[model samples]
Target: LGVRNLIQGLGEALPFADDTFDRVTMGYALRHVADLHALFAEYRRVLKPGGEVLLLEITRPERALPRALLKFYMKGVVPAVTRLFRHSSEAQELMRYYWDTIEQCVPPSTILAAMAEAGLHQAQRRIVLGIFSEYCGAEAGTDR
Candidate 1:
């Protein structure tokens, strides 16, 4: 309900009442949340019956060709660009490490199953690209 409110008072712990929200959107915020399941649980707690959760995210490519391209970009192009930013190869390496860890660490199914465990009724995923996906789900007892 407060998607556009822009209120500064709410903490990482949301201020809204339980079961008050209809749509929970975390657009690419997954990169920062340390405990993924806790975030999903909080979303589950706040969303009303039939409420939906939408997550837009960047994922490692699953296809071989795309994966190879991504490796090239990650290992080559991104580092080249980063060098322009700070004249620091370590910065580029750090940035590369970030994406590398993201690819090695996060799992799409783990995320979806966490939603299901949180009582989201219908959880599904749509791959937007070889390197990205959108996870959409609804609260338990909700109609499609």
Candidate 2:
């Protein structure tokens, strides 16, 4: 991981020049964003035409059983285990918050639509293990 040139910036207002990158990616942060439209617009603006965007997120399961199990694990078992291990209250709260965000995150369809509305093409989502979502979209054209 000898990466360099890491610049910290907001997702909705990326601090980059137009068409500067070939791809943009976000991992497990979609639920925390203030606005999907603005975030995707920023991604589109920073990407070179034909560039791609990828978002990796943990979505709540659609099935009731799996959803309930996940909720129990995240909200109950995780916090209980952390407390058993003598972790701080902040850590326990953080686990609950993580579950809350996933429970309240926008649907995959809405995310794809936002990508399309931001001018990206071929917007789609791939679900893994019934919970992990990989969202992908591409810039409209190869030529500016």
Candidate 3:
């Protein structure tokens, strides 16, 4: 499939009115933002009292070998992929910094704490692909 429904958006701010949406979905979109906490705050603000947000994310694996392999793959192979698509070294560098898809910058616990601080009632982190994560969260006031 080709890319479709491409959107221009600010990572830290969304355009929707508060408490309007039932759910917000993100695929590997939170970590690269300059302030993830603020983004979560916005998610909380826009969602209804019982609404939820589902996020697809990559996380550093707990095991040693898998973690090492993921880091190596991200650092070594990702740049090549960026070149294949972007065809520019500067773009590649930007991609490497913001879109490299590695999970090393922040730890798992920090993510959980952020959800809690963002007023999310129940937040869960599940790792898939042995190197990525799926996070689902709910608003604090009501069950959804």
State which candidate has the highest lDDT. Answer: 2
- The per-model lDDT (C-alpha) reads 0.77, 0.92, 0.76
Across 30-141, the per-residue lDDT of candidate 1 in tens digits comes to: 7666677777777877888878999888887777888888888887888889999889978988878867765674678888887788677678889876667799988874
Clashes of each: 0, 0, 0
Give the least accurate 10-residue stretch of model 1, judged by summed lDDT.
4-13
Candidate 2: TM-score?
Answer: 0.92
Model 3 stretches astray by more than 4 angstroms: 1-8, 77-104, 142-144
Error of 2 at 103 (Å): 0.9
Query: Number of the top candidate by TM-score?
Result: 2
Report the lDDT tens digits of candidate 3 across residue range 5-85: 776667468877789888988887666767778888888888998899888877767789987776676666877888998
Give the better candidate number (1 or 3) by lDDT.
Answer: 1
After TM-score superposition, the amount by which residue 48's alpha carbon in candidate 3 deviates from its true location, in angstroms, is 1.3
Model 1 clash pairs are: none
**How many clashing pairs does model 2 include?**
0
